[model samples]
Target: MGKLDLVMFEEEFTQLQEIIGRLQVDSSSKVVFLVDKNGQQIAASGDLRSIDATSLASLTAGNVAATDGLAKLIGEKEFSLLFHEGEKDNLHISIVGKRGILVVLFDHNSSLALVRLRVKKASRELQEIFEMVEKRAQSQSGESSKFESPFSEITDEDIDKLFGD
Candidate 1:
């Protein structure tokens, strides 16, 4: 089956925010954020005053999709991690729980080794949280399927009578 749409609870959201904040600080990154595979922002932390978050998330997702195509062509299952070094900054993007993307932005002040180590730990925590969200979504879907709508038995005649001319 395809991935279920996430229904983020407040508790999970809070956890995600905490994780992102800690990651930004721990990795010594300028910014850090999480986005779902569909390019929906989950949580973000650190400096975002100059970034277009919506566009970044959407573009990141598209980048991942393009990379996935390349990976397949090379007979690789998936490239879980990607890095781009720019003149003044760098981007470290990793896949989390096969459902989310974790992006970290850093510059000369940080070392790639430190950022990768911090990201590894953060990714594990994020994966667990995402799994919890998935389980909750599955259970809720199952429960909804068992629910009998109150209007299910209503007939056309009943509806017409309620609004009769």
Candidate 2:
């Protein structure tokens, strides 16, 4: 729940929100949300003002992680998307590269086919955006100096106890 002050988060968030605006849906249930892989909301649009975007983001991440873990248990690499259809609502999920998940919530009136198509198209663009951020991260990491003895005196047993393993 720490503040999302990470570099490039704002730029990426703004770009994706614009793409979400292109879909066009009802105001009540049609909301587009972007959450990190760890389930932090980077940006959102539509009728999410009352919603806790951060909690929703975290839950979405857990759902994706659970699905991916289940896939691995069954001998699959990873999952890219998940779609759920209910009587009055539908959920569309897309994995945004290695960094995050895009979750769209809408009802029966919204065209599933169109949503899928748009999500697929946007996923690639999101991937490219994330790659640039990663390159920046690598570049920044390269610029920093690694500490040699910040915690060198801490014993393994003490660390294990701290971790409570």
Candidate 3:
């Protein structure tokens, strides 16, 4: 019930990168990425430049939200995983730590079973990291009010300069 501020420290970010790296190899996935529930991309590995990551992250979050709603309507608590098979490519999405999502893109080279297996392991690790982040955030809550937000330093002229005529 406390304020949840998700902050990614350097160590946590490195662990996330490592998790995705291992997943790509173990699952033989074409791409692996993690996105927060709010549609913010956290980390990625493999052939990421080949896809529109921004759009994909946003859509994946939306997909998870929609599926969760459907599950509630059906009297289920939630649907944690989703898979979509394509003619040449496939997608596997898994909910992680209640605040993040793991997405895997694969082709004929990898089977859903393998992706699912690897994702399960990765999700466990990711969940732990997310918990740690939450704990850290909670511990720092007392000091958070004293800290100035980075955005607070940006002047209106700074934003206008980025799109000046």
Backbone collision tally, model 3 = 0
Backbone clashes in candidate 1 total 0
lDDT of 1: 0.91
Tens digits of lDDT, candidate 2, 51-114: 7788888889999999999989999988888988888878888888877788988886567887
**Candidate number that wins on lDDT, 1 or 2:** 1
Off by more than 4 A, model 2: 1-6, 24-29, 145-165
- What TM-score should be assigned to candidate 3? 0.89
The lowest-lDDT stretch of 10 consecutive residues in candidate 2 is 20-29
Using TM-score as the measure, the top candidate is 3
Residue by residue across 14-67, what tens digits does model 1's lDDT show?
Answer: 999999899999989999989988888889998899999999999999999899
Better of 1 and 3 by TM-score: 3
TM per candidate = 0.86, 0.75, 0.89
Q: Report lDDT (Cα) of residue 104, candidate 3.
A: 96
Clashing pairs in 2: none
Q: Which candidate would rank higher by TM-score, 2 or 3?
A: 3
> How far does residue 54 in candidate 1 sit from its true spot (Å)?
0.5
lDDT of each: 0.91, 0.75, 0.91
